[model samples]
Target: MQKLRQETQGFGQAVPPAQSAELIHTNTISRGTKFGFLGPAVISLAVIGLAPLAFAIWTSLYNYNLTKLASMRFIGLANYANVFSDSAFWQAMGRTFTLLIIALPVQIAVGMGIALLLHRPGIGFLKTITRLSLVIPMATTYAVVGLLGQVMFNLKYGVVNQLLGFTGVSPINWLGVPEFAFATIIFWDIWQWTPFCALVFLAGLTTVPPEVEEAARLETKNWWTILRNVQLPFLIPGLTAVLILRTADTLKQFDMVFTMTRGGPGSSTELISLLIQRVGFRAFDQGLASAQAMVLLVITIVLSRLYIRFFYREV
Candidate 1:
């Protein structure tokens, strides 16, 4: 037994226990190195992103009117209260939400269809041209699209009305009525952004394993079933990402609505961003604008979080 114990001790000594303290020291050094590399980026983010947000929050807390600086009194939360009570503000919010609700599903469905078509095999030269064409609308500026909308939707002599004349339909005032104007904006948004969603979906399609898809095809032989059960599951991540980004962007949409309609006819097209711009710049009520902006920020964050929670529950 003593001899066996001596042999075991010798076997143990052959390798020697690893130096845990040395390993810990090396890990600490690596962590420090990573942080050293990341420090500049962290500082830049704080300066550029966080600093502005902090300033906005601070401004929102105080009654800091740009025009009435001398009379500006710190009325905590009064501006927020006023925004909640304002009828025009509520109207703008309702319109904004209405547009979002109408546009989101249409964009997602059309974009996904486009992506599926583009991803299919057996396309050579056509694929390249199709991709390039789809990219053109997304590449164009929103302001440019809005300006084009203004010209194209003109009542009397616009190309749209002229096109309708061939079918014996009378010239429709595309941008004159509130409903038509809102529809025009939604259509413009869908046209410009559907390609973006398609691109994202296409990228997600690439990540799906081809073998798995083949296996599913063999099992069912029904393309729709495969798409719903296999392709759609694979697309959830891309869909979630597109939804979050588009929701935030659509909520803050200003340039297109501003350029096309100027929130006019009767403030029927006024989105929250337009309202904020009017309050801050036109009305010179910076405090109220800041308060509104803060509320918008909160709403955006909450919506984003809810989406993330719902979509990413598995993760």
Candidate 2:
């Protein structure tokens, strides 16, 4: 027993000093190698993201106008104050919120319904085709979608008007009138993004354990009950992602609204993004635009945090 105890103690003794030093040296090299691999990505982020943000913040503190570059001077928070006081800015923000309120619920509901349909057992070929079709709107460029909206919603020559004529209804001025134009934009957004939400929800559904679903079905005949009690928990992550992405996209909606309406029919459809564009480019008030943009960034970050806090769940 004494011999065995000595052997065990010897085996458990600290590593040789030379070997320990070698191990430490090897660990240092490994850490250095890891940082070396990460160096390019860190540098790229600094160059591509932080630099522009810093520049924008700096520009926001000055009275920098693209047209009057030589007259540019530091104005501190004047631009930010001006933005908050601008009635047009508030109107644009209100319109943006209106769009968000109207569109998000409809998109979520329709998308959830579509996801439920797609989740069911179906013909393999049909399922594959349906899934592929959902990608079409997402794959289409935003600018192209805007242009297409213009062609399709024209006052007289539009396909929509022609179809309405066949149904004995008057050809409505879809894009010419303020209310119709806003509604048309809403419809356009819903059409383009519902599939994206559907696909995301479908992905979430796919992760649900089959045994759990089967057990739920055995307990409840009401599909709604099973969905609420069993399936929805799995969908929280996807729902959170959809909310965050869609909210951000809607707030920054410029390309489609710009190409389609140009914020026109007399500023009725002027969203916050369009307002920023007009201030920065048309009015040449770079300082004001930068301030507006920074305010918008803050709003986006706040809303994203709220969504994550309330809805985010590990799946």
Candidate 3:
């Protein structure tokens, strides 16, 4: 027993507690190792994301117009003040919101309907193909969609007017007239994005447990009742997600307007993004454009937070 105990003590002394702990610690990440792993990510974000943002904010504080380089001076908050009081800027904001108000609901409602239609049990191969086809519009480049809209709404030779001729109606200026131009853009946006909203809602439907749905069906005979009280409750997260994304996107709309109307027909379709582009690029007022962009960024963040707070987990 003494000999065995002596051998055990010798084996234990071979590696001290401190040495064992050090070895274990080395196997895991140390503070320096963690920093090594995260250093590239931090540096990349600072250089790529934060550097431009800091530059833009700094530029916004100055009276930096490209044409009048000699007149450049630090006029703190003057650009922001101008953005608030500028009538054209407000008009552009109003047009952006107007399009959002009209298009958002239509997209959500149509998309939700399509999702419900496609969310049945045991989806077949043909139905799967049909669902996959919906992605084509969403996957198409927005620039391409804008160009397509330009061709489709070209008053005289457009397909829409050509079709109207069959019904004995006169050719109407789709993109030339202010009201029609606005409507045409809204229609084009809806056509392109409704598929995306449908996909989101359909994914939400899959997350709804079959047992929960069965329980709800047992309580309610009406399909509308089940939809309103059961399915919609489970779909809130998806609905809120789509709403926030669409709102941000619609608020910053520029590509379609730029390609199709160029904010023409007396600035009827001048969205906030188009206005910012014109101010920064066309008018060479970099400070004012940066300020406008900051305002847009703030609005997007606030609205997204509001959506998350109100509808995220309420269901």
What are the models' TM-scores? 0.88, 0.90, 0.87
RMSD of 2: 6.5
- Output the number of the lDDT-best candidate: 2
All candidates' lDDT scores?
Answer: 0.84, 0.90, 0.87
On residues 1-315, what C-alpha lDDT tens digit does candidate 3 reach at each position?
Answer: 344334434544443445554464333334455678899899999999999999899999999999999999999999999999999988999989899999999999999989988887666886799799999998988888888889988988889899999999999999989999988998999999999999999988888889989998888889788888778887898899898999999988888779888987789888999999999999999999999999988988999998899888585
For residues 117-221, write the lDDT of model 1, one tens digit per residue: 988897769988988888999888888888888898899878989999999999988788988888889998998899999888988887879999889978997
Ranking by TM-score: 2, 1, 3
TM for candidate 2 is: 0.90
Give Cα distance to truth, residue 152, candidate 1, Å: 1.3
Q: How many clashes show up per model?
A: 0, 0, 0
TM-score of 3: 0.87
lDDT (tens digit, per residue) of candidate 2 on 1-315: 344334333656434455554454333333445678888899899999999999999999999999899999999999999989999999999999899999998999999999999899968788889889999998899988999999999987899999999999998998899999999999999999999999999999998999999999888899899889889999999999999999999999999999999998999899999999999999999999999999999999999999999886354
The Cα RMSD in angstroms, rounded to one decimal, for candidate 3 relative to the true structure is: 6.5
Using TM-score as the measure, name the better of candidate 1 and candidate 2. Answer: 2
